[model samples]
Target: MVLGSAVPRRRLLLVALLAAVVLVVAGGVVATRLVGGPRTDRGATPVLTPGPSTPASPSTTPSPPPPPPGADITGPLNLLLVGVDTRVSVPGWEPHADAVLVLHVPRGLGRAYLFSLPRDLVVDIPAFPKAGYRGGRTKLTHAMSYGSRVPGRPKQPDTAQGYELLRSTVSGYTGLRIDAGAVLTFNGFDRLVDSLGGVDIYVDQRVVSRHRQPDGRHRASAPGGYTGPQMVYEKGRRHLTGWQALDYARQRYIPGGDYSRQRHQQQLIRALARKILDQGLARDPDQVQQVVDALGDTLVYAGGGRRLVEFAYALGGLPADRFVLVGLPGSSVGSGGSYRGEQLTTVGRRFLTELRAGRADAYLTKHPTLKVKT
Candidate 1:
């Protein structure tokens, strides 16, 4: 997650001209399309579909490519990292998200950047038949709700279909092509956390989370009770279990709410990344197997297995300092008046304008290397 956190550092990590670069995370059991089209069904077995493809073998390793050249800026290289929340039983949870970030990894001159698009940013929902929904802007997250049934297609009762709608909706909104996407569920997250053993996060404020066993339903801290919010942990630099760490990332009822919650989410992710690399989690076969088993049936990436492996390889060897993180710049985007509604706020037009104009190159040029503290 810390390696992932470099996404934000791209802002100042490039040399102070950072505002909102993002890393998108969607934690659902869904899969999406390649450059264009609908997502594949979750239950569908992956077949050796013949096409123009590159086969990856252990003997043929990924070569060390040169850094993205700075001058050749064109269209936005946006990556939508969505954390899907498939937690039903809660009311109106369709558009609800676990974590959502959009990363703008530069091809040249500038550093990789990130933008945290608030789930509550209200926007329009394109037309849908059974949805009876047509062009009316709602929270950005809500667009995912209409995924199962495209405007004219039949509802197939497939969650993977919903994820496809989400992928298309986000691409449409930014006018940026989504090069890649990945989806994981709460269980996948917990398994990943456990595989890494745990991650350390600095708890700035005192916030207690309570819940019951069997079903990890989150609650607020209170006095002794049979079925109420259980106090999970105290604030400070501490190690967390899979469930505890997930609760830390999943808590949304903080005093400052989503904005503050988003910031902390990045922080924890960074700490976890640092821990993963430090512990050499990938090198340990036992730990890797454990993580794989935990993530079983829960890990799904768009672009197929080969593409996913390629991405993993590209990112595998990057030094810790090569990372940067940033968040979208702007005022509060409303939550669409519903807890489970999508965030429908637009990014600062000026910031996005600069990004589209390739000003990030100058920003990256001015600040190539910056120091990161532990």
Candidate 2:
């Protein structure tokens, strides 16, 4: 859908930029409320603490070609992009890190690599004094739930707090200091899709959603799980509404399970980004404010140290072809067994090492299997 015209070119570009910058992350249409707004957007904004020490890797990330004339930020930028599975439909389900990604923009900013972290990967979670609970080993997804617990009231869940601990765990795991981070709710993702008039995604595999039914209403809940007619996505390209797009990416019961779902999530992100870019909103100014107004209450982006708008300008020049999707399996040999959690394959761990050392491009070239085919 194209935005209205009439605004100044500068104003139009700024608003259109929010669309590209946010969608360029993990879930595509995920992230914050773009500009300053109330917390009611249903999007969770997490402030980035001085999370981890930047690795001593050589500074070789190319200064992404100069952005538009006014852009400033440059160099290797690492953003922790997280999509939370907050089942607000259920009264007591705390959100977990459903889609965890590390978006590393090289020094040149010419290309960006998106690294997907397996949610179930088992790891040692450090203690968060705020939660008043000693950390323990568990699935990486649990980091969000653990961090979200209220200090004195354990039953209350605070996404902001949860995000902080998740950020810390991920920083420790990757050994890359995050410059910024964002956590977008799944419900908000739906709103974003609707705002953009739905998105189109290519289904790589047939997936039967475990949560939604054919009519789009959630299936009836049972002791084991939801039971009823399931919504199915056939393999191919499909134009999807908000529910369809979200349901398609939310599936984890398929062959690759969450790992496969990660690929789908990445695809969905790109599709949304493509949809926005295809509209040519970046060039037109007329209805740009209307587009921004439509998205006003949908996102809640939090820059690590910079304002969200500045990022819009900085990333405005990213070429569509420059986005590279790197998918890593969470487990090497545990999918068939009982699930304590997941572990990154040896290759996955090695990739992180190469990433920190500014050798990601070479390492990815050496291991072609690491790059997920779009």
Candidate 3:
């Protein structure tokens, strides 16, 4: 009797997992809707370009070389997806890239790999023209901020320039040519989740908020009229609303810190994808349009709206098992170190080499533990 009960429960879980995978593929396609309007053959997708003026370079700061002549993206396609804290319009504010993911879609679109780069990864940033800033080693997230900053110019945001700079920085570090890129605002992500009527994700562990109160206090308990920070999520299956999903994905107070948050972020993507598929958004043009509309003006992509739509459509049929998730191997430097940062491990170098050579599957086979289950 016990064995029979276990068998049914396991079967149910398997079915749910399969359903989630299908939804994720559908969701990935719909997520591209955030890029632009209905697909039309009117023109090529808009490409991001650098600003006209060049920044004065210091002796130590070397100018970035021009990108190699455009080559037809054959074989695997690499896309840099950056998640920023807020839309660029906030006056005098330079938003950092809170999340950076490299989405690798294999040649046949048979499988997809998502590799997450922690925000604190130490990397070299190139000088920006408008900013008159010399390049230096800094947190990977700061690459966007340095690119966007334009001293002696208007304080408004220049997302295109920022993305271009970040693209260059990532390309330099990864040794892979970035075919396209996307900048997604956190607020936009929240709305996308809400539009799908929320998502169901399996939380692997408890998640506590690390965001501080206005008075610079870590809200740990409700005392003296203080409610403290809420425990955003507890371990197990959770059907999260838009705001709750965002909070859950953003939490870094767990055991793994940013690494834990990175996993959650990737999980959220898969969950959202699953929700979209389960809701049949792919077949309903009106529903798809609604999802696009909810994204508003927040999503900015390198290729025009059409390219994203086309790419998403092409890969929509991929199964969930075909999706693989891995983090760039790295260890964080302690706070008191000369520079509190993260250094990529030797295995990370091997992973990058395999990725560049289109052998990520082999790498995964050798390092089975890195494969993240959706």
Candidate 4:
């Protein structure tokens, strides 16, 4: 079925800017500066590969033009976006997938659907021959860490290899073949926002910072928790600095907890989409060029075979309005007191079924509640 309507030409280009200038791991948007910092192996290609192979077609005498709207699509391109939670750069640090978002964009490339898997979701991560990880049942966040272990050097963990293993785990869990993916450190997320001169977001709730002090310095440690006055993000439409946006997106102590954090993260990306248009970054070639150059510092990507810019251009037809934030419902899994992790409910599993079956448009219509409110 058809998804997004006729997108204005200019806005379509901006959406590409959203993917290129800002960072999109597949899900609507990820949170933090996205942790791992600049790599020592920056020039080396990240070994990104896709699974559940595609149908091989004979070499065309002349390459065919891209499929048009309503035409058969070659993909159900499942992209894995994982935000790494680490204070140090890759290899030196063992990181987890702090925020996991899976973006499913159909072969049609007409529109895309972004959904999140709770970091605390409990699952059995399978064996990884690369990292020598045997795997076990634990929070999904740990999958990255387990996969990141540098086999020979125990102190160093390869984050790229980490994504490789996390990818396999996610593909198995969701039953969606991950075609392209990215591993963004918390640090990268903030730089992107600041590069855009900050974003204007309508904060849905009041969030008191648990990490930062009133003056923007990190809070001091205390017996039970952190000390000093906290930075507060008052409820309303306000311009968010990079640090502020990251702080807000990382919060999980609010009423809705992690779910609230997820929603706000989604909102941040939407705001970023609007900010690019409002700030006119999409139209400025020089400014856009700067963002492209700086983007490599922000996060590392695996295009499954293609370059990141190629993916950006291929999905350029996608407009900002077409990004659908899908919310999956589930509850904590554990005993009376201690918490174990999380597992998706039947409704959540059903969504994945429809996603793989290429019927998300119809599924979303039937269950409007599943769509995160814009």
Separate clash counts for every candidate: 56, 20, 7, 14
Predicted candidate 2: what Cα RMSD to the true structure?
Answer: 10.0
Best by lDDT: 2
Instruction: Sort the candidates on TM-score, descending order.
Output: 2, 4, 3, 1
lDDT of 4 by residue, 1-374 (tens): 22133544344344434544333533223332322223333454432223454565676364444432222224557777777777774555788787888878777666778889999988889988778888798888888889888878898777777877788888889998777666765544555566666778888889998999767788998899898899999988888877888888889998888888888887776667555544433333333333344455454544433444445434544566778888888888987898898888888889999998888889999989999875
Best by TM-score: 2
lDDT of each: 0.47, 0.69, 0.61, 0.68
Please report how far candidate 1 places residue 166 from its true position, in Å.
2.2
Per residue, candidate 2 scores C-alpha lDDT tens digits across 1-374 of 34455555444443544443543444334454232212332333222223445555586553333333215667578877677876766766777888788888877666788878888888879999888759987888999888888866755787777878888898899998776677766645565576666777778888988989888898998998889999999988888888888888878889987889888888877766555555544433224334545455454544544445445445545676777888885564355675576788889999999988999889999999888766
Single out the weakest 10-residue window by summed lDDT for candidate 3.
28-37
Error of 2 at 290 (Å): 9.7
For each candidate, give its TM-score against the true structure: 0.62, 0.77, 0.71, 0.76
Indicate the residue-level lDDT of 34 in model 3: 23
Error of 2 at 18 (Å): 3.0
Could you tell which candidate, 1 or 2, scores higher by TM-score? 2
Weakest ten-residue segment in model 2 by summed lDDT: 33-42
